[model samples]
Target: MNLRNIQYPFLFEVPVLKHMAGFAGLLKRDPRGWPSDRPVVGMFLCLDPLIFCCQPQPRPFGVAHHLATRFPDETFVFLVPITMSLERRVNALALAAQHRRFQKTHPRASLIILANTRDEERLLRRLGVDVRYAPQNMFVDEGMYHPIPGRERRFDAIYNAQLAPFKRHELARTLPSCAYVTKMFTTWSPQLKRQHLGKFVCSLPYNHVILNDVTADDVVPMDHVKVNRAMASAHVGLCLSGLEGAMYASIEYLLAGLPVVSTRSRGGRDVFFHPDTTLIVDDDPRAVQDGVVAMKARALPPDYVRATTLRLIAEERAHFNVFIDGLRGRQVDRTDPRWSFEYAHKLARFGSISEFEALVRAR
Candidate 1:
């Protein structure tokens, strides 16, 4: 596939391009590269148009609009890496409506890629849309986040996530010998001062948490090499988020052969966080502390973690191939690994008991 044909929204931006290069490298290995023999499946990594609007040269949005207008019959897929919180669900519904209107005009295949969670799948299905789930955070590029041989695991633990309230960076503050890394995004304007101040105010008491700001403006580039190097140097990955679609940092740590100490992420994380690989705990601080201790005591084989990560990636690729094949009107097995819902209950189990009870009561 010629990546050139698919205009990347922030291609001119060096920082975003660096990150995109890593993802593109993985896509290059896929059997369905751009300019493929089969029907084209245009995949947008994000659905936020504001990101492109903020760019000085917003060609990516224009290209997307052109695709919808010119090639209405082409297959398109939009990926949502983040979970659909109540507020996000509202936005997603609007986007779904827009896509539905586009489909009405051209009548080609379209799908939304989300984490393997029954709530999200059922939500979209109820809205009359085609949806698919990857067993893990499928957007993680294996080429960018793999174990580096001979690299010593210097740090006992690493917390790699945004410094938002839901991430619970304070939980990591008490962990011994842990490195904290975060990416802060904000718009560039006079209000940027207030934004930084607000972050500072919110991070009080735990003031040691240093944030690496990667705002909409080119303040700091997301250096994957540096990020991956830090991840590889850590013995364990820590994710204390109250909720998530699939904590990308946790998966990154797993792919780097570091066992994870994570809270029960309410999304696709359960697909991989088995007894052998991760220490799952409640959101309580004491539980997190104990989980960390347990993770340290556990001797998880690096090879085992690496092998499991590769298998997950392979499975994701197989699922994508099936989606693509279906777009081509080819007969495909519905019972293939791609269609299995065995892991759906994993997410359901961790979901809110009150919510479940309400649903049961409603029925």
Candidate 2:
């Protein structure tokens, strides 16, 4: 796991590496043939290394593209967040064309693991790259989120997300009975604080929302343990996100055996939502209020919630293995009933050219 000798020639200048070193260390120790002296470089070359390419941010994408171009002989695997629909900021057509060009020019040099489902696949295919679905990494630690049999339900509702604009924390202004648990500040730098003062001020109104006949406490950030405890004691959880990759907070609520009242998450949360477990509503105040009332009145079986969480956890792990195995030039058992045809096709399609040649020699 020692990465002291590892060289990140391109990313050495990036400030975020300091925060990511520990996670990189864990990747260095994985049995997936991670490069010992050049761990970052190894990640690109390793047989199916799981690279979490967060948010499709410009910098990360540039870095990955640079590495893939520089080391064309190596295979790069990326877990990417695919936008379901084109946003004002994102050009889905151009992005898919870029991927197609890369795949065509470099062939087996890169593989994309998409976070969203069939919609992303369809979009990418229209853009000329046939993308396949992979399970979004949304698993929670079971030990942290499991239900406590005798814990008292103290709060009527809880909102478990950061005080960010996309999360729609202002929705709490409409739900007077809900407790808002969110971070006080995004960063500590005074200069940055001054820059973000408008956004900070905009979030301040949520703190003034009346709850339980009193002005609720200023939203305070707590560690996972405290958040889990608060969720365990709450009767329901609220997720008012305008969009989501997976809505991790909603999954946490379900894992804690609390019925979730959520707006359409517009992503992977659709896989988990059911009438028996969740109340999906529009972004309106009255609809949320009615959904909250319905959620409280309905009875959700704790065992069902627990079972669903476990099932998702298993699926995430299995699909992740499939991704890894595909990257490693290992043949997945096609005869196995659990093997997905799309997964098999992607493995065979993007497999290393040398590996395919070796397979031909063996045959």
Query: lDDT winner among the candidates?
Result: 2
lDDT of 1 by residue, 90-127 (tens): 53465356446545654553434343566766766677
Q: Rate the local accuracy (lDDT) of all candidates.
A: 0.52, 0.53
Per-residue lDDT of candidate 2, residues 1-363 (tens digit)? 224212331112224452343333222211223222322311122323323232343322323444454456655555444532222113445555566655676574554636455665666666665456654534345556767778877666788765445677656556546665565343334443343334544554432321212113233457667777777666788988755466667777887888888887655666666667888888887788788778878756666776776676677657756665665557444454444222321121232323333332343
Score residue 5 of candidate 1 by CA lDDT. 18
TM for candidate 2 is 0.63
Residue 226 error, candidate 2, Å: 2.5
Q: What's each prediction's TM-score?
A: 0.63, 0.63
Candidate 1 off by > 4 Å: 1-64, 72-92, 108-115, 188-222, 330-363
Q: Lowest-lDDT window of 10 residues in candidate 2?
A: 25-34
Q: Estimate the Cα RMSD of every predicted model relative to the unseen true structure.
A: 15.2, 11.7
Error of 2 at 214 (Å): 19
